[model samples]
Target: MKKLLTMFFTFLKIGAFTFGGGYAMIPLIEVEVVNKQHWIDKEEFLDIIVISQTFPGALAVNSSIFIGYKIGGVVGALLALAGVVVPSFFIIIIIAYFFLQFRNNLIVDLVFKGISSAVPMLILVAVISLSKSLKKELSTVLMILLTVIAISVLDIHPVLIIILSGIYGAVFLRKKVN
Candidate 1:
């Protein structure tokens, strides 16, 4: 019960203070979950990040659920997810209320422009972080290259790319356990 409360509060703090979404939350989560709380090791935490992206939800939400489950099972997952979402939900509602009022302000416009400029750098950092975490398997590397080329050069749908990659992995990289 105490551990669940701690997990909830920690994730709540993470969700509330973070801005610019999941990428911005990474460094903060690393400090809290890995360095401070010791809930998970660095490599395992990073692995969570990688696996979370393949899921359908936001990265932060998925990460919180996984960490919560790791710490204290299903009830912990519920608590952590509630902690992560509730603050953001209220904050977004508050912001949405005022955004219409300030939409035309020059300062607001400039701030939004500045944020847009930073988005690409944030995405690049996310890529770099994931790349550092990736195991250096030949098939994984080839799939990464193929996915990049397919998206960038061929303009293929990412779903199709992922599907093809999965087929390739199944056909060629299946492990044989004795």
Candidate 2:
């Protein structure tokens, strides 16, 4: 029960303070779940991040579900989910109620523009942090390069890229027995 409450409050704080969504939450999640609590190691956290990105939902929510389940089973998952969602849900509700009235206000528009500009920097921080964990192998480097090209230049769907990368890794990157 105590663990469950801790998980809930941890995720609640994460959701309440984070502004740029999932990617922006990665470093904070790592600090709390890995460094602070020692719930999972860094590799496991990276795996969770990969899994979260591969799935359809928001990365932060997916990560919370995975971590919560790992720690406290089904009930914990629910508590964590609720904790992460509730703050955003209420905040969005309040914002929506006021936003309609202030839709044309220049100050609000400028504030939104400032936030939009900062979001990319937050995502970049996440990317850099994640990259530091990557193995310095040729295949890993190539995969990263290919993925970037696929997403930025080819405009390929991320799901398809993930699928193809998985297949490529399995077939070509797998180690052989002596």
Candidate 3:
């Protein structure tokens, strides 16, 4: 019961403090879940991130659920999910209620503009952090380059890329069971 509460509050803090989307929350999640709490190791967290990206829901939510389940089963998953979502739900509702009145206000506009500029930097930090953890093997590097090219030059859909990558990993990158 105590562990479940702790998970809920930790995720609630993560969800409330993170300004941008799931990508922006990656570093914060790493710090709390991997570094500080020791709920999971670094490699496991990276795996969670990858799996979260492949799923349909938001990355943060998926990560929360995965970690929660790992820690405290189904009940923990529900608590963590609620913790992450509830804050955003209330905040969005409040913002929507007042946004119309504040839309043209100079202070509100300036605040939003500042947030817009910062979001990109936050995303870049996440990308760099994740990249650093990636394997430096030739095949891994090639796959990374190919994925970037496919997305940027060929304009491939990310979902298709993820699916193809999964198939490729299963076929060519599987580890031998000793």
lDDT of 3 by residue, 1-178 (tens): 9989999999999999888899989999999999999999988999999999998999999999999999999998999899889899999999999989998999999998999899889889888888888888898899989999999999999999999998998988887322
Kindly list the per-residue Cα lDDT of model 2 for residues 29-112, writing each as its tens digit.
988899998989988999999998888899999999999999999998888899889999999999999988999999989988
lDDT of model 3, residue 3:
85
Looking at candidate 1, the ten consecutive residues that score lowest on lDDT are: 169-178
**Reference-based lDDT, residue 132, model 2:** 86
**Clashing residue pairs in candidate 1, if any?**
none
lDDT of each: 0.84, 0.90, 0.92
lDDT of 3: 0.92
- Candidate 1: residue 51 lDDT (0-100): 74
TM-score of 2: 0.92
- Which stretch of 10 consecutive residues in model 3 shows the poorest summed lDDT? 169-178
lDDT of 2: 0.90
The TM-score that candidate 3 achieves is 0.95
What TM-score would every model get versus the actual structure?
0.82, 0.92, 0.95
Candidate 3 regions exceeding 4 Å error are: 175-178
